[model samples]
Target: MNSTLPHLGFGTFRLEGQTAFDAVSMALNAGYRHIDTAQIYGNEQAVGDAIQASGVARADLFLTTKVWTEHLSRDAFIPSVKASLAKLSTEYVDLLLVHWPLNHNTVTMEDYLSSLKEAQDMGLARHIGVSNFTVAQTEQAVDILGKRVLLTNQFEVHPYLQNSKVVAKCRELDLIVTGYMPFAYGAVLKDPVIVTIAEKHGATAAQVVLAWMRQQGYVTIPSSTRQVNIDSNLKADSLELDATDLADIAALDRGHRVANPDFAPEWD
Candidate 1:
C-alpha cells in the first residue's frame, strides 16, 4: 500500500439528491481529494458533477467506485465498470472495488478476479480491490490474483469493530485497508471519552475517531451530509492524537458493527 494516498477520504454512502451533490462539493472545497462512491449508492453521477464543479484536475483526484454485487460475474463485471465510468464521466478510476464478497447470481473467486484483471488490462480502472470482504475471502483473492493484481479490502472499521485480525492480515499482505464508518455511524460521537478528547484537542468526536484510524495506517472514509460535519471530517487529517488518547478510544471497543446487511457474511 502506498502511504502517499490520502488517508482520509469522503464517503458517499446513503447520500442522495441535492444533499449528496452539495456535500461532495463541500468536501472537495475542504481539501478532500479522495472520494469513495459505489454503483449501489446511485450517486456516482452526483459525485462526478461535484468533481467537475470543484474544478479539480482528474490527475489530482483519487476517485474510487465499486462494482455492485449483482454485477460480479465475469461477463457483467467489465461492463459494469464501464457503466460506472460513464456515470462518473471519467475514463478510468483510481480504484475499482467489488462491493461485496458474494454475488447474487453465484460468482466464483476466479470469475470475479479474472474480470477485475480484465478491467485493469482494458484501462477501465487503475487499481482493483474489494469491499466488505473477510480475511479468508481476501486471501482467496490474493491467491487467485497472484502478482498481477493489487487487492485493497474496504470494510466498516471503527472503534467498536476494530477489525484487528483483518487489519493485521492486510498489513502482512501489503494490502490497503479502507476503514468505512470510522465514526461508528455517529454512535461514537456521544461517548464521554471521545467528547472529552475532542474538547481537549479542539476537534470534534468524529475527528478524534477518524484520526485514530488514520494513525493506525488505515484509510478512512467518513460520510457526512451537513456542511459543518463535512468540514469537521476533513479536520481529522490534521489531528494528532497522543498515545493516551489512542488508548482511551481503543478501550471503547464493544465489538459492535453498524452496517451488517442480512446478505453480508460474518466478518472475523
Candidate 2:
C-alpha cells in the first residue's frame, strides 16, 4: 500500500477557474503537501497551474485525482488517466481512484478493477483506490485485484454522518479511510454539540471536527477558500481530543449525509 498520502489533503471539488488556483496556491502555502482533485471537477488545469506556480517540487507533493464514472470502462480508463496527467502537468499522480461505483450495466466490477490495475501497471498512478464504495463492493474489488492494491477509500464522513460501517470494513481490509466533506458541507460547524466541543478546546468547530476525524485515524480533505481557514484547518492535526470529547462528537452522528446524488449507490 502507498504511504505518501498524508492524514489531511487539500480538496479541489467545486474550486475551479481562478478560484481553484488561488485556493490551491494558498493551501500549498499553508503547508499542505497532499492535493486532491478529479476529472469530473473540471479543474485539473487549475490544480496543475497552482502546483507549477507554488514552486514546490513534484517530489514533495502527493497528488491525487479520480477517474470519473464515464471513464471506468477498459477502453476509456487508461486514456482518461493520461488526459488527467496531461492536464495536471505531472507525469504521474501519487494516487488514482474510481470516482464512484455506478453504471454496473456498462462496466462490470471486474472490468473496472482490471482497468485501474492496468493504469497502475502502466506507471500512470503510483497507487490506486476507490471512492464512495461500500463494504461489499470493496470486497469485490479486493477479490478482483487479488491483493491489497487499494491504498484508501474516499467517502463522505463527518460528525453528522459518521459512516462507521464503511469505516469498519475499510479498516478490516487495511485500507485507509479518506473522509471527504468532513465538515458536513458546513452544516456541522454551527451544530450545538460541535459548538460546545469547540469551546472546550478553544478551537473553531472545523478544527474540532477535523481533530476528531484525525484522532479516529481517518484522513480528511477539507476545502477552504480563506487563508485563515486553510491555516486553521492544518492546525487541527495538533488539537488533541480526549475521551469525553470523542463521546460528545460520537453522539452527534445522525447519518446526515450531504453529498448524496441520485446516481449514488446505496450507501453503507
Candidate 3:
C-alpha cells in the first residue's frame, strides 16, 4: 500500500501488443515509476510483462488499474479485479479506480463502491477512487464511502479543458486530482499560445503543457511510443512555470474534452 504517487506517470491507452511492451519498457528505462493502465486497455498483460522484464522491483513502482463498466456489479467486481491482478502479474495494485460511474439503471453506486472497498479490505488494492466522475458524483461517492479516503479522482484535465469545477471539488474533498490526456491527444501541441510559451521557455510544447499540469497541483499521465518523447516527458517534473506562464495557459481552456463517451456522466 504505497501512499506516495509520482506526479508524472506513463499512460498506456490505445497501446497494445509489442508496442505497449516497448513503450512501457522505455518509460521505465527513462525513470518513470508510475504506470497507468486499465482493464479496457486490453494490454494489462503486456504492461505486466514489461514490468516483470524491466526488473524494476515491484516495490519501487506504483501501478494503477481501473475496473471497467461491465464489471461494476457486486457479484462481478472482486473477481474482475483478481483477473486484472493476474494479468498485471502483481499481488496488489497501488491504486484501483472505477473506470466510470454506473448509470444506476443496472447497478447503484453503493454496490460498486462497496465492492471497491471490499477489494481494498482483501488486499487486492492499496487505495481506491473514481475516474470520469462529475462533481456531484464525486460528492456522492464521498458520502457513500463515509470515512474511507478516496486517494484521487482521475478525469480529463489539460490546457484546453481546465476542468476547474471538478478539480475544485476534489481539492475540497482532499483528494488528489489525476488528469489523463494531459496533451489532449496532441491537439494542444499546435496551439499558438502553447507554442509561444514553449519558445519563450526553450522547451517542447509537451513539456510546457506537462509543467502546467504539475504546477497546478494535478498529476498527469502522458504517453508516447517514441523513446525520445518518452524520455523527454519525464523531464517535465523539473520544468517550473511562473505566474505569467500559469495564467497564460489557464486562459487557453475552451471546455474541450477528449475522452467523452456516450456513457459519460453529466459533467460539473
Candidate 4:
C-alpha cells in the first residue's frame, strides 16, 4: 500500500447533526478530497450524508474511519467495520485505523492487530493503521504484523507536542505520520509568532500551522464546523513558508500536549 497521504484532510471528530453535514459539504466544495471520520465520533452517518450530497464520485476521495476500542476483538472487529461502512455509505474505506491500543485486559495486542489484518484481508479497509500508539507500541505492531502493510501511525502531533521521538522512529521504519489536532486545539491561532507568520503570508494562523505540519511530511486532519474555516483549512496545501519562517514556527514548541487520554495505554 502507498504510504504517502495528502498533506491536508478534513477531520470530523466532535461534529454532529446538520452542523457536521454542512461542514463536510463545505469542505468537499473547497477542494478537500480526503475526509476523516470514526465510529467513536458518532457522526459517520452525517459524514456519509455530506459525502453523498456533495455529488462527488467516491473514487475521487480518500475516506478514513476508525474502529472503536470496545470493538477490538476478532469477532467484533468485522461487524464493527461493517457497521461503520453502513454508516459512511461506502463499501470500503481508503484507510481504517485501530482507534486506540486496547487495554491488555480487553484484548491482547496480538489479538487486536490480527483482527485489523483480517479487516484488510476481507476488503473492508484498503489500508490499515493505528492511532495514539507510542513508538514502542508501533515497534511491537511491526514485529507482529511484519513490514508489508503498516501504512501509518496517527497521533496528536502539532507545533507544541512535536513528538520528535516517534516521528524519527516512524521515519526510520518508513511509516507515514498522520498528525491530529494540528492546531493544538486552538492554541496555535493565539500564538504571536504564528500570527506574525500568517500575516506575512496573507493566510490565517490555522493555515500556517497546517502548512508547517505538511512541510514536515505529516498528514494533518484538522476539524472545523465553520464553512469559512473549512475552506481556509484546505488552502494549507498551497501555502509555503521559507526556511526562516519554518524556523520561527518551529521555535514555538513547548512540549504542550492537548489530547492525552488518561485511560489509554502507555505512550513513550
Candidate 5:
C-alpha cells in the first residue's frame, strides 16, 4: 500500500499447485509489479517459483504475504513469517499482514500486534498491517505498533460493499487503504450502471471499477488467471470517471459483503 507498491496488485487467494504457478507466471509476464500471496494460500512455493522464473529483479517487485491466524501465538508469530519468507524464497516481503484477526477472542490483540512489530524490527517484513480488521481493531493496531506506521488496512471495498466507515477511519489515521475484491467477485460486471459507464469510456466493466477505486486513492487487487484480463486491469489507471459516473457507482452500494466468516468480528 506504500507508494512503491503498485496501485493494482495480482492476488493469489485460492490459486494453488500448478494452477497457481501458471497464473502468477502469466501475471509477471503481463507486467504486474505487485504480487500478493499468504501463508495460508498454499502456493507461496509456486508463487516464489514464478517470481524466480520470470527473471524480474526482486528490487523491481513489491511482494506481500500474510501471517495466518494459526500462527499468531507469541512464540509462533515471527517463526511463521520466517517460514513464509522461506516458502516465498525471498529474504523479506514488502508488506506482511495478519490474515485474519483473532477477534473471536482466541488471542490478545496486543500480543499479535506486538509480534507483527517484531517481524519488522528483525527486517523480516519491510512493513506490517492487518486484514479483515474492524475500525476499532485498526485503531488498536496503531496503538500497539506505536510510532511504526500501520502501512495499510486491507478490506473488501467495491460499489456493492461500500465500507465508508472503515474507509474514513483509515484515512483519519493516515493509514493506506487496500481494497480487496475490488470487482465484487464479478458482481460489478453485471450491474447496469457499471455497464453504462463502461460503454461511455469504451472500457470493460472491470476497468470501470478499478479506475473508480484508484481515482478515490485506494489501492486495489483484482485477481485474474488470464493474461488478457491481467493486462487490461493494469490499464484501468488511465480510465477517467466523471462526477455523474462516480455518483451513479456510489448509488449502487447495497452493503453486500463477501468473505465473511462465522468467527469474524463485528463490521464497523
Candidate 6:
C-alpha cells in the first residue's frame, strides 16, 4: 500500500486502435492519472495519442511501460526504451519494468537489470521494476541492482489467484505488489460468494472484487472498454468492505492463475 503508485490504474493490455485511444482518453477524463501499457501490448502509440488529446499536463500523468523480453539485451535495452518513450510521446516514463524474465539464459539478470538502471540514470525512466518474475528471479534482480530500488513487483493477484507466496517475497524485499487481472479476466465475476457480496452491498461483482483488493492494500489495474465500467472501477475506492466481506473474499483464493504463457517462469 505504497502511496507512490496510484491504487487504481487503467490497464491497456488488449486494447488497440481506436479502442485504445478512446479508452485511454475516457480514463483520463474520468480522473485516471496512472496508465499502464507495455511494448508487447502494441498500443503505446494509441495510448500516446489519447494522452496528447486529453490535454492533461504531462506532469499530472503517471505513465508506465515495460521492456519486452527481446529487448533485455545490453545493446537493445536502452534503445527499446527510447522507442517506447517516443511512442508514448513523453520524454520519460514514470515507471519502467522488465515485462518478463527470459525463459532461456539468453539474457543474464546482471545484464538486463544493469541496463534498467542505466535507463533510469539516463533519465529515460523515473522508476524501474519487474513483472511476471518468480521469487528467485525477484531476489536476483534485487541483488544485481544492489542499492538501486525496484519500485514494485507486478504480477497476477485476484480473489481466485491470490499468489501469496510471491506477494510475501515482494513484501520482504520492500517492493510494493501491483495486482493485474484482478478479476481473472472476468472469471471471478460469476462466483457465488462474490455475487452474494455484490448483492449485499448493492454493487456489481466487479466492484465488490475491486473493493476487496483495495481493502487488502494492493494496487490493481482492471481494464474495460466500456465507459461505465471504466468509471465504476475507479469508484471502488469509495466502497468500504467490512471484516466479514474481507474474510469471505480471502477464502475465495483457489490457486487459479490465468496469465501463464509458455515462457513464464516457475511459480513460487
Off by over 4 Å in 2: 1-3
TM-scores for every candidate against the unseen true structure = 0.95, 0.98, 0.98, 0.96, 0.97, 0.98
Best lDDT among the predictions, by candidate number:
3
Model 6: residue 150 alpha-carbon error in angstroms: 0.3
Encode model 2's per-residue lDDT on 177-235: one tens digit a residue.
99999887799999988899899889999999989988889888999999999999999
lDDT of 4 by residue, 89-108 (tens): 99999899999886566688
* Model 2 collision count: 0
Instruction: Let me know the TM-score candidate 4 reaches against the reference structure.
Output: 0.96
lDDT of 6 by residue, 203-262 (tens): 889999989888777888899998999998888877898899889888999999999998
Candidate 4: where is the Cα deviation over 4 Å? 1-4
Candidate 6 off by > 4 Å: none
Q: RMSD to native for every prediction?
A: 1.6, 1.3, 1.6, 1.6, 1.2, 1.0
lDDT agreement with native, every candidate: 0.86, 0.91, 0.92, 0.88, 0.89, 0.91
> Model 5: per-residue lDDT, tens digit, 60-89?
999999998899999899989988889888
